[model samples]
Target: MTFFYNLWYSNSLQYKLISLMLYPFSLLWIIIDKLKFLMTKPYTSHLKIICVGNINVGGTGKTPISIFIFKILKKMGHNPIFLTSGYKGKISKPCIANNDVILFGDEAIILKNIGPTVVSKNKLEGVKYIENLNSKRKIYDIIVMDDGLQNYSIGKDLCFLTVDRKSLFGNEFCLPSGPLRQSLNSCKKNINKIILTGNRNFKKNHNILKKDILNSYIKVDKVSVKKKYLAFSGLGNNVKFFDTLKSANYNIALTKEFEDHHNYKENEIADLIKLANENNLKLITTEKDIVKIPKKYHLKINCLKMKIEFDKQDLISLKSLLKNKLND
Candidate 1:
């Protein structure tokens, strides 16, 4: 099911009924989570915890955004490390983010460039690893969590809720029935910041439920394309990928978008290369897609670098908030 279309059926009201019947599950889920928060000790000590998460389930570009903040922290001389429930890896302890995208997935590998990073499924275990770090050798002051908006075990001073600009509150249904991880109204109350990825919706009441914390709305555009290219990606919203190219006025000769978190095969790379050569087009893809691709085919590809374009005041507030967090 393509995340958004899973909620309702066209012919019958059956889907809606089923979803309504299961709505209690969302309430139950919310209650259980609140209880978890009430019971779990909020392991907080003035250390800055900035959560970059989303409203819908996939494709908000949290990893790149996290790296962007991490780089800024580095420039300002504050050590930053990335923490994640390390989606998909089986590593036990908070090992240095050393594995390649193929090994530990793209997000963890990407953060390694900025500073120390760890991917543990357990949040407490991951934080423990950070706590026991060598105090003498460049201790980390700020933690940029990639996907912890739902995690209450660790309290964050500021949480940036990232939503794929195209799919904000997909189908507006919670989990199994839709793309939303939780209720939309809950997000408005909990999040410290709302970051919109890609172009603005700009329609009447486009942001009906999210009017409150729309402080940071980031849009990604493609770099100027001086040449014709074959575009493809394994991202959640590949339409946004193609739209970015279109916005840049780049003519795409061919494009093949895969499922989210797709693992590339040697044959897949070869097929794309053959197609690109046949069409006389240069291959371009997103960074997340490039990581899953085999290294042998890397020389043949160039991943589109995503830059977050923000308004002036928003940028100032974000930097100020970050600065204060670091100083604290």
Candidate 2:
């Protein structure tokens, strides 16, 4: 994708054809999406559901936002359930989210730390799991769904669509030509809230994000000064991740970059260990990456966590909306 992304951006002709082909489907998708929206009709959850989704295909920090929502819901004294499509995991039968990265992927694994989670491609199945649960042990008071924006099956009490600052709208085209899973226009009308992740000014002037959805950068409170560790992440952009560590005041000893969702091999792990030792650094990775790492190395793993600072007005409005959503 990285290699092709460059080629697609550079060649307008290539980009145009791809877009043209998708254009018909994109149009059809809009109609289908609208019909689905109108026909399916959003169902009210007995327990509240907040979904963190986005227009982009990936890398909008949806997972982080999902985790934050889970925490917020629990802090309010409501049990929360996380729902995901289980992108690459195996478990055909719907199941509760577990803390096994290998089994449920890193995102869902981190989510479980906050509350109960369920991974199922069948959205209704996940919802039904909760509806049919013991009325006594009603494990979840609410649900936080990760990446369920276009999914019409399970209705959300609230929806926050995430946007990557750097690649806000890849080539301004839809899938196969660009990174968007749906049109940017689709997000604005459907989403209850829009969250812009990364540096404060990530996608400053895209007409879509810049106008009103931007949120300030969540500043780093403290960081290790003298001795630092080598932090490597394979999320969206490696440079930005490195910059974030630096901004947080960590003097990174060494940084290694890799493709998104890369599977770390034994030899590669050994190389990282050697590099860290040679440079006198510890290994720090993102929660997403750490999950792929075998448990034998779990003790050696460290991940950085971030805070989301919503605007004062937005925050107040959101809190109120959520309270009502959860109550109703």
Candidate 3:
């Protein structure tokens, strides 16, 4: 993963050369992806499905945006639930309110705390399980998929492709050669809207973004931590978390990085605590990371809660789009 970490972000000649060598593998990857689409028709769900996903290989603030959209749907008096193909988790079948982070992954655990949540290895099966769960008691109006734009296992009612303004499309190549999961043209054909997950002016960065597609902006919420702290995260883009802290004027004493979807061990936690004590720095991490840790350590660790806010016109447009979907 670290090799990928370097290959995707570094501008060094060596990395570029390696990417070139791996270019053929990327082509194979895209073929396999496309073949799956050709062979299998996506499952159609009865409920409206709003998919907040990305074509980029790493994080582009999908979770925060999903939560933001969920809040809006709830305010509109609709029973919305989160459905995801839970990554890095062991699940024989779809799980509902599955509190075991080790079994369902950290993201699902976090979502369950916020509202009703379901996870499956297959998103189509996940939707099926939700329908069964609803029949027993509670009913949900819509399903908000956390991340599955690339997985065409289920038909999506609405799709929002999240993009990072900075590393828009690394090297503008696909897979092992770059950060894209699929080609930009293929992505354009699939996604309905683009949600840029940073405050950078799209007008200025438009040359890099290039597409004349409909898009909106959402700034990552940077809550001011009152004290100096050490930050750590297992996000696909950990630098963003550290940068957010720095931007919020929070003094970051030390920073720790882990592979995306990293599962913490006792020794690692002990070592981190030891370092924090030695430096007299408070422990801080993203809310996503905190959910993966033991509940016992919750009091000792602080989470940087992420909130997503869109521009006024964009917010209105987003809401109207959802309402229209419901009406349909």
> Highest lDDT among the candidates is held by which one?
3
Q: TM-score each candidate.
A: 0.84, 0.82, 0.91
- On the 0 to 100 scale, the lDDT of residue 80 in model 1 is 76
Tens-digit lDDT track for model 1 on 1-328?
4434446322246667667777777777767766776687777844577788876666776776787778878888877779876565556656666766645667676676567888777776677777667455648877788888777778777788776665566557676565677677766777866666665442222565644343334345445566788999877677778877777677786788788778888998999999999888899898777777777888999777766666677777778877886666
| Local accuracy by lDDT, each model | 0.71, 0.71, 0.81
C-alpha root-mean-square deviation, each candidate: 3.4, 3.6, 2.6
Model 2, span 105-133: residue lDDT tens:
66667677766778877877787777777
Sliding window of 10 residues with minimal summed lDDT for model 2: 209-218
Off by over 4 Å in 2: 4-45, 134-139, 201-216, 219-221, 224-229, 236-239, 252-254, 279-281, 298-301
lDDT value, candidate 1, whole model = 0.71
Instruction: Tell how far residue 106 is off in model 3, in angstroms.
Output: 0.5
Colliding pairs, model 3: none
Error of 3 at 22 (Å): 1.3
- Score candidate 3 by lDDT: 0.81
Candidate with more favorable, higher TM-score: 2 or 3: 3
